[model samples]
Target: MTLTAIGLAIAATFAGWVASLGPLPIGEAREVSTTIVDRHGKLLRAYAMADGRWRLPVHAATEVDPTYLKLLFAYEDHRFRSHAGVDPLALGRAAVQLATRGHIVSGGSTITMQLARLMEPRRQRSIHAKLRQMVRAIEIEHDMTKDQILDLYLTLAPYGGNLEGIRAASIAYFGKEPKRLTLSEAALLVALPQSPENRRLDRYPNAARAARDRVLDRMVEDGVVSDADAAAAKAVSVPKLRKPMPILAPHSSDAAMSSVKNKPVVALTLDAPLQQSLETLAHDRAIALGPNISVAILAVDNASGEVLARVGSPDYFDDRRAGQVDMTRAVRSPGSTLKPFIYGMAFEDGFVHPESLIDDRPIRFGSYAPENFDMTFQGTVPVRKALQMSLNVPAVALLDRVGASRLSSRLKQAGADLVLPKDETPGLAMGLGGVGITLQDLVQLYSGLARLGNVRPLREIESRRGEEREPERLLDQVAAWQVGNVLLGTPPPENGVHNRIAFKTGTSYGYRDAWSIGFDGRMTIGVWVGRPDGAPVPGIAGRTAAAPILFDAFARTGKLPSTLPKPPRGTLIASNAKLPLPLRRYRPLGELVRTDGERAPHIQFPIDGSRIDASGGDGMSAAMPVKVAGGVLPITMLVNGVSVGELDNRRQRLVDSPGPGFARLTVIDAKGAADTVVIRIQ
Candidate 1:
């Protein structure tokens, strides 16, 4: 056969051998480490792969800094683009140098050849190994683009212990991504991969600097960088320690990863900068509040209900404060933070208008009594003023008329997880923090108010592909506007600079929890401060502890406090004189008089025939409390006609169950009007 025919036959045999190997394990070959990123693709946190290597995703020339790519090309392979994965001229030069110098000077392996070795990973150096690499490089070039070959090398290139890829090395050493590498940082990353173990900056700063300077000198010689740039880059100090991978929004990241496992990258709705800022704020505030006290802050986008920032605690590793617990999801007393919803219900019911008169004096509803946050009361204030001041009496009075069960049911319908005490029915105290709720729930509810009464569950992972949840109606548009208007006029932090964001502050009974929830047109934020152990932190009040933080958070976000939308059609924007009769003042509970000249007292608690579990489950016989509403003062109660008790304060009165059995509850007002019901005590 002729020489050309023999060459063709040889090529055909090599092609047959490569084809016999079957398809490449492209997916398994490029397994990258898991990463958690913010909405804008900025790294929030990263986890090592099963092999304990940081093999981060790399996309050839685009995913890396242009300067670093240029330097890498100018130094690693000058004729890389022209070569078909192998350069005969460069190999010949290496041969001559090795023969004359009695040593191997340069390997002459192009980027593709390096990628071939990385794919199979053989440490031995021999003629046989070199030949295998050459064949593999040619095969890789045939099957993949130049960029794909480079991507493989960048993904699998070792960068010291457990660190691989330009992105991983850049983030670990320089504390940044490779997308914006400086000259010095670029040089350091380029030089480390050659002899990663020996020249690790974090382990051997002097060796790493020497290697980096060599690369800088090569860049200057190759005309990739000016002499001045090289000299300046040489002057820059190499990083002596590897930075911990970013752990921003740890709680959110953990939650997301737990929900969706093994994802190469998980993008969340969290804004990285805002998340870090809120975390810092939480840390600083927690320190100021003393040991064991933690601060939880949550900010959400009103339009999408996406949680931009959720700082569960001041520090994730703080054992004393139980920082690992996500307080944003913890069920705790919401204090008067929920009063707006009560008044919101009243507004929706058309029982009171923002400008209408409402009494904030001490009030009672049968056996339940409600008191103002402050011991004093602001009797006969505008409905707006009553809500803005977070008066418990007025809120409970409204709750009495609206019915606690209705309010609770509405909240549940609006996507709030309200935890009531075991076996206790919804009571007037619920209007004053008698129920348990989470900061997240409060944020969602407040976000609804910001969205003009539409409520949706807050979303954490932006990439979640779940079916969209339709927004539920939490309050009528007009009522929502009235609530927002009232809260917008609330006193700002002591700085006296009002953000014009409607907000409310609440201090749980016994100072166990301090909460402040506020929202504007674009965003809503909720803040909570107290000991994580549920212990009372004396002197911790919402206005003093959380409201300032809430305001500061909004300020830090760099978003202006936008006003809510203009009132919808049904909204009344007129003075009390111009308002309709119902909008002029709160109607009395018994305004619809009965024919007997007496307003019958309604048993609010036990709900007529509702079962009451008299056992506390702690080996104690807890008495069942009976409550009444819409009754004249000095109401008398008869249990099985024995006259169990008589009390003036509408506070809950505990009555002995006489063991679990059916019992009769009767309430009579001084007017001789009576109401009766029977219930079973379990």
Candidate 2:
């Protein structure tokens, strides 16, 4: 062989060796951008990858405007389709132009070659780098189709700091996507990547405008756009700074993204328009609420259990209110919010009918005495009237008979997490805001009532095909109907009620928390207003503070409030006279004669305000056995209205030590008759 032939054979062998090393380092070239979209595919939020670059997904010419694509081909590579990887005609013209002008003007790289350079970035400008790019460009042409190459170019081109691709640039600069870019906006995007840092519209508006006009002039010369169109495009103003991306449903987006990790596109169950409007309302209303107060709102589709909108706080960045904390998920006192469930359970158990005459007068269960919100009580009221008034005495009276632990168990079974004081069990006070719960759990409970006691797990993501689920039974259909009917008659807020919606309001002890939750046939909404730091805000009551917002939220949905369904079968809607004798009056054990003719069980020991010494043991509780003289077997002993334990037919029972303090002791028999005594434990 000749010497030149030998040299060509050696070079070919080395080229083959380099090809075996696999493709060039694309360096997150195909990194899918994480996006959170609403049910309608509207963007709610966008997060950059770990590398801090907004590399949004992009497609070929179709993903971009047709006019922009034509201008790109005319200016960047007129013969892009005909070229293998490099355009020889363009290269020859560039070489001639350089020679004639004694300086370089236009580049000879095709779109594919530009993509190759972008994939394997090199800082040094040299002939060797250019040759490497050319070889890689040819390799890419062999591996990918024409459309794929264009997609890479569209996605990998840099626009400014920490931003790449036409989609990112369009959203940041114009507050929109590239699919519907105007003539001037398209020209600006085309010119940006050429000199990203120098022509950044945020920092150098004049330079950006000049670069955009240059592209428009080229478009006119190339006959891609009319002269009049180019002139009009040149006159358009460029954005001075990057506008923020869509940030609706901030908390919901964060939560959904965290749950589904590393996903590029996360479709949530939120309604974009509804979420935006609620967020604005929350912000404006919170500002009016007072300093250091945050508000949270959650709206759910009752039938599907899908969360339509969740505003975690009025302002997520407000440090004063601890706004970063998602109040919907934070544990706080729910106050009278759970009263409806107690009544519903009572109705289900046949303990009381809606028209049953229950005494709302002053009542005491040990030292734990609960009063109405207004510090006064109605002498005697029907069950329906007491519930609508949110009378605390009646709720506690019913909860005592229902067993607080049973109430807690029912809630847990329905997918609610209650946070009680350390080492303290469920008690009568718990029925009156003594326990802790989150707004999310409270909403779930109310949603169950709206679904007629069927509790479906809350859904945050868009439902995928073939997903299976089951609804839990929280209460019987009849019980749920009674509760809904009673709550529907609750007095409306300042704005008169135009539609029927069953709702309940709650105010925690010392005004630390305020809550309002409501539900209709289709949707259920819950609102919370309080300081996230657990600081009390005087005069912040649920009926006045949170209920107003809840009512407005339903109104702002742009649809009239849905009316609840009629009472289901077996629901008793009759007056006291028409109801059965047992259902007409709720008489406790001591209040009525038992079948055996023995006086209903009563406490004969530890008289009211008696002091007893128990210093022989630890500081937690007194070391004395509580004494119960009369009544039925299986009695319950309570300290401060919280159940300590149960007692059998025996007269004396060992009781839990309730450390040194003034504590009230009470005994409840099987018939719900309760006798209380105040004593000092030491």
Model number with the top TM-score? 1
Model 1 bad stretches (over 4 Å): 1-23, 591-682
TM-score of each: 0.84, 0.83
Give residue 192's lDDT in candidate 2 (0 to 100). Answer: 89
- Model 2 scores what on Cα lDDT? 0.84
What are the lDDT figures for the candidates, one per model? 0.84, 0.84
Pairs of colliding residues, candidate 1: 366-650, 367-650, 367-651, 367-652, 368-650
Q: Which ten contiguous residues of candidate 2 have the minimum total lDDT?
A: 615-624
User: What are the root-mean-square deviations of the candidates from the true structure over C-alphas?
Assistant: 10.4, 9.7
Report the lDDT tens digits of candidate 2 across residue range 461-551: 8745236357877888888888998899899899649347789999999999999999998899999999998999999999999999999
Q: After superposition, how far is residue 365 of candidate 1 from its true place, in Å?
A: 2.1
Candidate 1 lDDT tens digits, 469-500 = 89988987878888998899999988436747
How far in Å is the alpha carbon of 562 misplaced in model 1? Answer: 0.6
